[model samples]
Target: MQAPERIMSCERPDSEEFCYFLAKDYFRFVLDGSESQPAANNVVETLRRSGSSLDRSGRELEHCINKLNLSSIEEVERVLPSLMREIYSDGIDNWGRIVTLYAFCGVLVSNLKKKGVPERELIEGVAQCLAQYTWTHKAAWIKENGGWEKGFVEHFQEKKNSHFYTKIAAFTGIVAAFSFVIYQH
Candidate 1:
């Protein structure tokens, strides 16, 4: 985290394709901004298990949700923040909880859509929240952490972050399939 050489602009992220990939790949399911949105119950379980699949943090979050018998969108909605806050505090080398956090958020947003929440609301709300997160809460941390150029590229490197993986070809194509999150447009 040696200051990333240079911090990047939040508007035009240095590691932009990572955001595009998240939108195209990981978040492709809910990318439909169409008018006729599905009701919460009508939505399938495609993202239901996403949170619990990545790592232990996800499992623990799932456990707490289960233990509380929090099955509904309303129920999990109430308590998930506290549980996630705990996980965020743990940090664990920054990369440990990175993908897990996105999976958890993606699960919740997808569920909200299923529960009849409008896509616009979910979309705008996430955008606003990300703005605050990057500019407000973690601005200093993100700056010192090298912003996306170093953070996104280094953290989600495919196989290994060799010189080969440092170029746009590797950054955009290979690593994108199974890696990356956190910095999204």
Candidate 2:
């Protein structure tokens, strides 16, 4: 499940390629009953191949997961609120970031579901977070700037543009992975 090379870039805080690769890798790990160490190593390799740094948000997620020492629904319930807060408050303000959050949540929920854990609460929590911080604000911002298509086009075409398609690819990859996870549930 290799992402296209051209989709890799360092500028985006949550690279779409990285998010998709991480979620896909994690989902596979869960399905395969593999240990977390292999998944983490794969994530590092994927990040390197994508030419994306593991930014603060990614590191924070790793730290939260490691510190919690749980892989069940309890872990998702305990860590998600703080994770969402940090991602929204201090992370990049972009569609990719929002999509990354959605993808991450989707992966967690899917994993829980596969483990036969009741996932309604976690799913609702994710929905609430997205409704409050992501979809609502993103919709308003897009409306204020025109619609999504126009807004994104204009935003990417502005001065100092670099790796515009890479950003779009990342966004697309995240959305695709998010959809896949959601479908699995």
Candidate 3:
């Protein structure tokens, strides 16, 4: 089957917000059941055609959903860590890709919860992994600027540094909030 055309634009490919929106739209499309094919099948086909590392992860995730019956919490527990590790280990240097993966995980976790899966452990594990990665990246930026102590002092003093980190935090918060809303509806 031919993959559906990408509906969202990615002009700001480096922006976390852009990637999060793209992931949200993609998940919404897949989960809404607006297409003739199964959502997992369509997602896999689309990702297989996109040829990006993020898409590759999506394809693998679709396969995992199909193969392991993700509706089951036990199956998710067995599969999620390795899937997360694969995405993390793929050397995806782009923040957009990382954000996309983070959003995808959020959507997946939310969906599983909606399906009545007890997912405290799964949510905590995924959140911890993503949070650690984000912290590591931010720490590197702080180190490059001077060091954590100096950076923290300067971050409050400098409007630019404060604004940058605030934007990052806001984007993360927005994605989390959006995912919760999506799951609720």
Model 2 clash tally? 0
Which pairs clash (backbone N, Cα, C closer than 3 Å) in model 2? Answer: none
Candidate 1 stretches with Cα past 4 Å from truth are: 1-11, 14-84, 90-93, 158-185
Question: For residues 37-155, what per-residue lDDT tens digits would candidate 2 score against the true structure?
Answer: 44234223332222222122243333333444445665555555555555454333564454355445544555466566655554544445444444434555545654433544344
> lDDT, candidate 2, residue 7?
36
lDDT of 1 by residue, 59-99 (tens): 44333223344334444444444444444443432433344
Q: How many residue pairs clash in each candidate?
A: 4, 0, 0
Worst 10 residues of 2 by lDDT: 48-57
lDDT of 3 by residue, 59-89 (tens): 4433333444467556544554555444444
RMSD vs true structure, all candidates: 13.4, 13.0, 15.7
Q: Give the local distance difference test score of model 2.
A: 0.43
Question: What lDDT does model 3 reach?
Answer: 0.43
Best by TM-score: 1
Residue 168, candidate 1: Cα error in Å is: 28
